[model samples]
Target: MSNNGGNGGGSVLATFEAGTQGWSGTSLAGGPWSTTAWSSQGSRSLQGDITMSAGSQHYLLKSGSTNFTGYTKLRATVKGASWGSYGSGLGVKLFVKHGSSYAWKDSGWVTISAGGLANLTLDLAGVNLADIKEYGIQFIGASNASGTTAVYVDNVVLGN
Candidate 1:
């Protein structure tokens, strides 16, 4: 349970155990997103077809008002299939929204090897945690052949 009754710190934001778990996907490249059997925890994971193109933002988001006032970290398990590369410029981020404003925190460019699972942690500094009306994942830019990459995310949690 979260401090604000599942809307804040000490909460599992998503596990993808029950369908999409309120998360939806969108991408500039028009790739599809869904829940897949490949997961690091539970029975499913959120899968997004992210394009390895500059300026393309592919994400899976859940809209809600959450009070994450005391949380300083966001964690998740991720894996990628057919990933082209895992070097500089290839990264991911977590974003939180308050009203019309949004704050983003990078995952320090954590590497997700081809078909390998990895734990990702991002700092929640400078975010308006008190009124987080939306939260999501962002697949950052990657300079590779123009193609789509399959990425899976699971066990998203918020904590100290």
Candidate 2:
């Protein structure tokens, strides 16, 4: 996989084709374990049931060909489910790795508390991508909070 041109003028390095069913079977770097979709704590939300469990369900992505030197930007579009009292509420955590056995460090988290859609972005300003071996997206929430909350994610892009 190659890094996408910062100006949005190059080919895609890698992409997860989330089908209508809301789940993708591919791994981060052709790994063995399959990354599951989003999970809910209660009834299934309308945003499309793609969620993680209270603990598991973290998805990893390898940069492959793209390596960053300076500032980089990552963005994604997501739709939250309209279930429960607050509807489809969720939080996303971003992580980055520097080496093969290195642990994933938290970059940031974006919370979606409404029933509508929201756009999230994070700036990798001082991160060193040279040693970044893998990046991950994890869902964090409480039990009884309706793990069945649905979510729709698309158009994940990175730039430098």
Candidate 3:
């Protein structure tokens, strides 16, 4: 992990410039994650195919000793193929692992239009970030629906 001292926040966690950077997705409807040229920060971004479903959780994880002790937020640049039904279920979250179980945090529903890159931020004010064995990005919501959709993620950072 490289620290960029980002926009008055903290440091760069993953930019997917080289590759998946150890990030992998689970419960994917479309998958085998790969890098794409569609990026908001660097040369490439991580891409995955996800099926939208009510009350479903799909995410990607990377293992590392990430210390978020002084960081108050997590930010990432994201792009989506289709945001089916614009319900309150469309948003992102964070999963941080300290022990065996992972502690989760939410970003609420963000207004991201299709075909454009959006900057999404999640609060880390109450998250336990010290001695983190793993960290991840979780996409939540898209309630009462089903089908595969594409999502791209890039320039992940932790800051205040």
Best by TM-score, which number? 3
Candidate 3: clashing pairs of residues: 10-159, 89-141
State each model's CA lDDT, in order: 0.67, 0.45, 0.69
C-alpha RMSD for every candidate: 4.1, 8.1, 3.1
Best lDDT among the predictions, by candidate number = 3
For model 3, the superposed segments whose C-alpha errors exceed 4 Å read 1-6, 82-89, 99-101, 111-113
Q: List TM-scores for all candidates, in order.
A: 0.75, 0.53, 0.76
Model 2: residue 85 alpha-carbon error in angstroms: 7.1
lDDT of 3 by residue, 13-106 (tens): 8888788877888877765355664777657888877777787777777776667788887787777765445344346655566644565555
User: Which regions of candidate 1 fall more than 4 Å away from where they truly are?
Assistant: 1-9, 28-36, 83-89
What is the Å distance of residue 53 in model 3 from its true position?
2.7
> In angstroms, how far off is 92's CA in candidate 1?
1.7
lDDT of 2 by residue, 1-160 (tens): 3434243542232334332223332211222121233322112211234444443243534443246454376555555557533333456655566555664565476766746565555566655666666554554543424445445454455664
Put down candidate 1 lDDT per residue, 1-160, tens digits, no spaces.
Answer: 4333242447787777677777877773433344664877656788877666655567777887778777898777777775555434445666666645554445565544456566777777877778777777776655543466687878788877
Please report the TM-score between candidate 3 and the true structure. 0.76
Worst 10 residues of 2 by lDDT: 38-47
